[model samples]
Target chain A: MSSYNWAPGFIDDGDRAQIVTSRFQYEDGHTLDRYLATGGYAGLKAALARTPTQVHEEVKAATLLGRGGAGFPAGTKWGLCPEGKWPRYLVVNGDESEPGTYKDRLLMERDPHQLIEGCLITCYAVGLSQCFLYVRGEMALAQERVAAALNEAYAAGYIGRNILGSKFSVDIVLHWGAGAYVVGEETALIESLEGNRGMPRLKPPFFPAAIGLYGKPTIVNNVETLANLPWLLTHSAAEYMAIGTPTSPGTRMIAVSGHVRRPGVFEIINGTTTFRDLLYGDEFCQGIRDDNELKAFVPGGGSAPWFLPDQLDLPFEAKLVGAAGSMLGSGAVMVMDETTDIPVAALTLARFYAHESCGKCVPCREGATWLERIMERLVDGHGTENDLDQLLEIGQTICPGPFPHAASERLGLAAVPFPFKMTTICFVGPSAYTPVHSAVTLFRSEFEARIVKRKLIPVSIGASDE
Target chain B: MTRLNDANQVLAREIIGRYPKARSATIPLLHVAQQQNGYITQEAIAHIAELVGATSAEVLGTCTFYEMFKMHPVGKYLINICTTMSCALMGAEQLVTHAEQRLGIKAGGTTPDGLFTLERVECQAACTEAPCLQANYRYRYRVNAAQLDQFLDDLAEGQLDAEIPAHGVVARVRQSIPVDRAVSVVAPDDVHEAPVWMPLSGTTA
Candidate 1:
């Protein structure tokens, strides 16, 4: 079979350093032997040779950040863990649940050891006795592969007591999450790990570092962030720093889906490429599928805001993309062509938010359902002139407004839930409104076109007057 | 009310052993229990609570939150057709309509014969392969009407048992962690059977 360019972890044009996805080049690359041949465990061995502080120093020098949606510095987060705390845990987030994002799935399936080595390095740095790898419930293949890899690592004496003849030893337990999107949140994940509903915990005393799994200090890093450790440790920190921008260092895996000629995953240097290049480059997606003109695209996953073709020139960095009115969250770009229906797309996202709401908070629970209903009515040709404005108002109430005030507010009416901002205990509430808000602003005509002419309402006493 | 077999019980113990605290193993044990019974029943809930060192109420709290863990008895094959953006763009709604027509059931209904349970789910992370559905969570992508009909035919004949087992069976590969490398397989001493399914008040955190 010809080697397909549309392969996960397949970089079109780049050096073959192969940090997170090094094993994609070989057959059965997940096996210990295959990974070892590619200099995989050398980083862990080097980390073993040095003190944990030095490992932290190297990672800090690289300025590595979390690859999960939130881009916090990973090394500093590790530093925040209180020193000499017994049973301090390291949790690697393998729960790749964001819509249109699947890079972590590939990393877990194709090269389990990369993640394993990363875990080993992290556990050593943070002085943790164990690390929990939580995989999503639906990823059966990823779970199986990771389980087998953990078994192999245990058998080889890389895990358990006195690992690799070093004083450091970290036990790994793999947990499978039943289908819940909120579990991807670190605190919620900890709750799910404790056999509770995966509801997000409040901050300012509930941070994972201060209070985490089993009521102990825990360092929770994304799979991609941890996977970068083996490479940065083996290579010099300066070398790793040179790969990407100063703000967002190192190459990131971008999963390009939806209306692309060759939809797949590719690792690109951060901030070096634009959406246009990623979408149209021959070595990349080879242009949009069916030669359809691009209408709009989701800069990140479905939860992130949308961007029109004019914004395609924005660089692929989190802060830059955020400045451009979108986010590179999860690095999954979903391209929508001219034939796409913006209202229907907005409805799909709204429905997802509504269904996934944990029903804990008020604004999220009520506002999500209201937004979904309004969008549904808009798409079904039953919307009125005020319905579109009503969706914006309700979305603002759910998300809390600072930017892009609802049309009703512009019309000088009383703002529903005025001066609201991040009221919910978690980000899920704000997320429920993001897509609807973005769609209404970018494609107002689409929402308005679905509205039918307003009819007069009849009063009970004056019914015969018609 | 069926309980896990002796072999599955042993497997469950090993999984429980992996966790430092036994209560953390609740989800894994639930998966095993669901694999034993087509869905989690009272008996399986009690047994899982016993294994994971938690209350039956606590167990139910966890189980009810996740969508994948079935609370009621479902058909043998769980047909989940993803109707999200990617699939919807490729006409997944039509596929859902067609599947519902062919099965003579709605999106969330199970057939009269107890063979197929149809569900119109969100994305299954196979967006690249548009218009995809899963037969018992095993993906079948780029599916048209003809392929769906063929799949239904195969299901009717009971020909896909080797590839796709009946509902609730988690994985074909049995979980057997070797004895020596297994960490802390000993169950906690204070473990007891759940008294009842009473959801306690206060401190849900």
Candidate 2:
């Protein structure tokens, strides 16, 4: 929507990945006419001609997964809604508030029509008549572009009232979330869409696909995941599946930020690209900025644990990264060079989780705030060994794992049951401790170096008060 | 001035009709109300409550949850500086420290003259353009101390006024749905009131 003179993006790296960002390769692709000229809504036309089940089967065959943090299969998610539910809704998760993730922002602003067309395909396939695009509030330019494109679509009969001579009449409402990271969660997004405070609802009773958006069956997909629809529809599922691994097929957008020579979103074939290639290879980041040695990198977004330089040669796939005790979450590679202060970095990421924690669950709400406080003290050089112990203790209490004490020693603490099942309602609980825990574990010396024990004023041990 | 004016009320109603439930319009109406006044006021919240069929406390609760919906007045130009990981790695902290020195106020403080307020934000989603800042929510990429000075000078002399608006007015290009495509006009009794900003049909281009 605005003029720009950024670098020639990572799309130039053709051999590494099929360039899914071809629409964005040109500046004019954001407009409806330009997008149509580039064969954009042709997918929707082809999709509408087929039966809804056929449309569902094609998507299922391709196995395109959600680009949001969950990485759930987009096709399987569509099948979750039970049939015969009238007024079924489609929600486009454009709330890309992940710390190092900016791929959706680029997609929304650079080529919005592809995303809208993707939404139309999903709406038709799912037999849903209404869609709500919950865009982040700060994305003003993206909203403007999408709004202008919607006006064009409305005029061309692409959106609203019987589409392309078909009986299906679909409408999409562009809604805005003020600014809450928790709303990225489907149920919290539903809560935000309902004109209430965005809070993550407890699952099982509130699994969004089965019952969501005012207790109706809803399908939620990320912007980037939906943007891939036109390409998949135009090409055969076999062609799409040939791009990446058998499991995590197709190209994925990776927002490579932090200490990179050319920091921007780079699309890569899943399970092929490694963290080292992303941060150092010519096609991607072109090496860390100032030619410094890469010390550590967040393989995913802020929630991901830091990957040390020695361990970064592993492929960028969910299974491999998960095997390495991290995740390919949101595919945001945030790098930090040798000069970075480990304690400060931990505190910064910890603060984000704490600030965004919606105060809904005790583990996330209390745990995040508590971790942020301890991390701050560590960064400020007033940390004690006890503070480190306290952080681990609190983190476990929020989402307890193996009992820290002996079975015999745990006799009295049985009342303090822990969720050990990943803590709170949302991932915010474990995410809050991700950076803090990782830093304490991987860089113990760094934490110990920052310690400057504060002397407490001597006090009589509870004198006669008891 | 705090209440949605005669014209904006129609726009509010049109937005309300877009959703099955009228209460869903609360967020958009809050934006329109904020634009009318610099920030949301008690009267505007009350007006929005009545329009959306929600309680004042409920509206306030929703408003408070979002960081963008300002409850108090802000400076004419809000300078949101990104100090997150990506930007920090590229020297955003130094820029912030330099900005504090230049402005004679720390981040989140408005100048005494109230022209600009500098805020250290998490990220503005412009990580590629490290050390970026948003003036009145418009992007300023790859900024340094020199750029900050020039921006302030331009702002002080009303040079950047054409590009950047006052705090509350979010978008310079208004959203004007065509008359024929206006969802509000579908029902006469339900939402007959026409929005003032709706451009005549076929003229949006």
Candidate 3:
């Protein structure tokens, strides 16, 4: 269990509140002894002392937002399970597959007891009888660490039947998911847990809290979202609210990669911290790599639209970033310096979504792959002028909206808001269109330059033609 | 084609018991099947369907949707070099090219010696350690051409066998939960009252 030597880049400068990551700096932190020594399960003890409604209200008062892609409030999502529903199930979404996002993976590997405690408190509050932890299959170390932690906890009476001598009893099962990016979405995650293709079910009738896994009431919370519960319950909700901005009242982990001197995961004050503070601040990534100037950055994971240098002062708040034509989705910031090739950068993401399309939706399957083909030809200097327009036209078939772009300020085109219109079942279709919309809108000159320098090689049909 | 041996059959039953519905155990059983044989054999797939109460086609459908399950036999070591956006920004493509040249095989091709298979993959969630790759799903981060060469040499010489297992072995640690400690589970229709753990009507904690 102590074999994992943590890679460098987990910052613990003591400047900000390290709620979830406080134990990450210590060796053997994943072990039960280290976890118990570091004030683990104290939250569950404190929570068990209160009524279920009281524990639920305290979490609501703290205003803990989901750290997964969507920033929905955790308390409100818990309250949606309908009061009289018996035998509710809690499903923890540990399948952290979003590209550029690795924060949840760290949480699961470093301090699994904290997450296990969080789940205990949550199941007690939500009146859930059973819990399922769904982790990605590719994360071998994380799975082993969590499994060992669970074995230790069960033997210690932290899990299974009347935990800690309380009337509340719950069972926690760890399930591993095979490789599929679509399962990161909650509904798709539920489908995958049922041993089906990880395709997103339609909303309204299929809302998880009402009718979910095995046709019973279920609540799916992110790994990081539940990981915060232990810390929130150990301290008062007001104490938790005292830190960070009023709206986003807690610290959040942002995984910064790409051309940065210090590319790693750092816990920063939510909403108050700006992109400039993150990229250039001494406590965070110390500016672009090799003294190079920042060209463009994806404010979120690969699904987000690209942001230019002009938007560097924007804060980490969801509303602020959403208003400015992108989102802090998944808290994965990817920076590109002056040496970046814009078309190729866009194609890298385009190719990913194309390869990952579940093929359940035709627009995402066909349209994303179609866009990748054009991007490949364009990058290879074999594209025509019509290919650029074709990329947008095909993208429009998937998303079908005036795309939210940062260039709308300069171009004078009216900017559409967040929750872009989509023709497909889930956001994967629109996710594929984001790179095309961003690259074509902001870096038109780059695409045009590549296409204008198109090279046409003569074809030799037979041996005689050579 | 091969079937699960006596020990794997016992393991398969334990995996199936973890779920309330036998069908929910489909994916895990597929993993066990792959672990038994490098690639999921036709016989294993049929056997899994019988264990999970699913048809063979249904089992195949679920297996094909995931990227990790390989239908055909691969090399002894599976090296996945990531070239996504973050990794691509850090010259991950160049690392892939170097690997291709040294291995003398293209992205999806296996080496002639049947020892190595290289694939240019998407993000491995190790972006900060850009230009990363996974040998049989165990991560090797911040890799350069020299590091890759040394890694390949070590892998070929069995120097890193303890760290990185064969391609089909996901992890050395297997999860086993005894039945008595498990939650009281039944069919969805059988759950009528408030859960046994929840305090009845006006009783306070």
Candidate 4:
């Protein structure tokens, strides 16, 4: 079996759970014992011994960033959590439901004990006596594994009252949310946990860290984010920060799929690795298939902007990708090789976002379906010269600016225009426009060929022969 | 058969109590019904709806919306082949073909012997092990046509044992018994002890 070398700054000597791929080596039956033997609950024990502020400072010093697409600073988010709220809840968003994102699924299913350890540490840091894992409902096995691990933890007295002989009492609840892409959002996940529809909520006073989950303060972190907490607690914040760049710290679990030789999840230190090293790893990926020319890549799952071949060397950073007019929404890299029809792929993606749109907002509900129809027409060789411009125009109208619409538009009524009174309503609506816009921008000739003088262009190379 | 014993009723009631409204309890109720009946039947749906105080339409709609809630009767074991993009690129079609050949039933159908139900679904999020299948909610990843055959044989011969290995584990492993299959009978050696994690008070976690 081929093994890739660990990237520089990777903690190679710690427990198996801290290592990227070694974490899940244990089976479900032995996970709890193995985890316990490896100082899994040591962080929680240590934190219970210290004050919540001490735990928070240790995490903040580590400079850990959220691994659930957003890459927000985990410690800062936790620090912003409101104080004086007793029984604060810590929710670990385990709804790894992104289409191309599977890293969390592997972690939750294979090494659930590690996640439990991370959650316990986080709960202690945030003064939360109760923490709930909102696992994706589709992940039935993962749910079972985590549920089993929680039982083991409780029986061992690592969880429940007086954990590890400390006065700090913490309980971990494993709850599953009905499968939905939007539920991955923190607020939507909270709603789903409360037995409501999975829908994103408007922000401001309702930020989950302050007022969340039964109107109590809650700290919601991603699976990978919480999974890193145990490591941060063991290692000092400065030591943990020594690995990644100044802004982004710790390792990121990148799930690369589509048209790759060895498609799987990999743990790479933030800022130490580039897109090229991830895609063209000597044995893995094996470069683009069929020696076909590279087309575009959805750098961050389906929501991020598409990157051309020239941009493959770009660093995987949120700000950098944003500078390139693409947000690294999720570190799910989807590579599309040559010979694949870009328009068709965009249409398929558009249809998905359209169908899955919560229909709460006008732009997302109406705009996604509209983009899908236009892309279908374009791919079917019925596009006109004006259609290309129309698609771009529509994209601007939906996702208009570089950033997604304000949180209000995402949660409020569709008629509520962009925060700036611009065209698009929310990120989903504008995000739906990304693939279609990229397809048109990159393959204008192909689209133009389809539009014949007055009729739909024929469905042939260069030009639609219809 | 264990029959609808008090333990089963208590489990059912506990699941119902999780939901604030009875109508929202449809899926959990269906899970309980499926646990008892093996496969959900129309009668089971009606019974669940009656228990949950929901209309047949509400129950049916809830069942159809989620992939886990099976509307029709399935074989003794259900093989959910993930046809999502990740699984598709990983040769999920070949896996489905292998399953069909082994069971003599196509996707979304059950075999004549009522031992297996084969179906395709969206991503189960086990993309790392491409071409993965969920044999009754327990993932069997890195599967191909031949692996599917061996798995079916193992299940048929009752050689399947669900043993969760210890940590630091490598090797593509398969669990023979479906998770739901063991839900009815509490195995004597079950690693998980119930009520240990169950909260004693009304406080929500």
- Give each prediction's DockQ, rounded to 2 decimals: 0.25, 0.28, 0.55, 0.15
Clashes of each: 0, 0, 0, 18
lDDT of 2 by residue, A329-394 (tens): 887888888888888877778888899999998888888999999998888877787888899888
Candidate 1 local lDDT, A1-466, one digit each (tens): 1123222334445452446766676657789888878896899999888767678889988989788887788888877765434446788888777777878877887788899999998887666666888988887777778888888888888776667766665578888888888788888899899888999887866469877887777889898998899998888789988877788778888878788888767877786778888899876788888998988888788777777776777788776676556667787888888888888877887888889889888989999899999889889998889987897788666654553222222233221221236777776777778778878877788888878887799557755755
**Local distance difference test, each candidate:** 0.77, 0.78, 0.86, 0.63
Off by over 4 Å in 4: A1-22, A25-30, A204-206, A283-286, A290-292, A377-390, A401-427, A448-466, B1-5, B13-30, B37-65, B71-120, B128-135, B138-205
TM-score of candidate 4 relative to the true fold: 0.76
- Model 1, range B1-205, lDDT digits (tens) per residue? 4777798798888777777687888888888888888888888888888888788899998899999898888999999998877778778899999999999999989999999999988877777677788888777877999999999999889898877888886555533455665444323222222111111220000
Off by over 4 Å in 1: A1-17, A404-420, A457-466, B174-179, B182-205
Q: Is candidate 1 or candidate 2 better by DockQ?
A: 2
lDDT for A422 (candidate 4): 32
lDDT of 4 at B82: 73
Lowest summed lDDT window (length 10), candidate 1 chain A: A410-419
**Per-residue lDDT of model 3, residues A265-377, tens digit only:** 88888888999999999878989999999989999899998888878998988888888888888989999999999999999999999998888889999999999999999
Error at A355, model 4, angstroms:
3.4
TM, every model? 0.91, 0.91, 0.95, 0.76
Q: For residue A223, what is the lDDT in candidate 3?
A: 91
Supply candidate 1's per-residue lDDT for A168: 65
Model 1 misses residue A172 by how many Å?
0.8
* iRMS (Å) per candidate: 10.2, 9.6, 2.5, 10.1
* Candidate 2 residue spans exceeding 4 A from truth: A1-3, A6-11, A16-19, A402-420, A453-466, B173-205
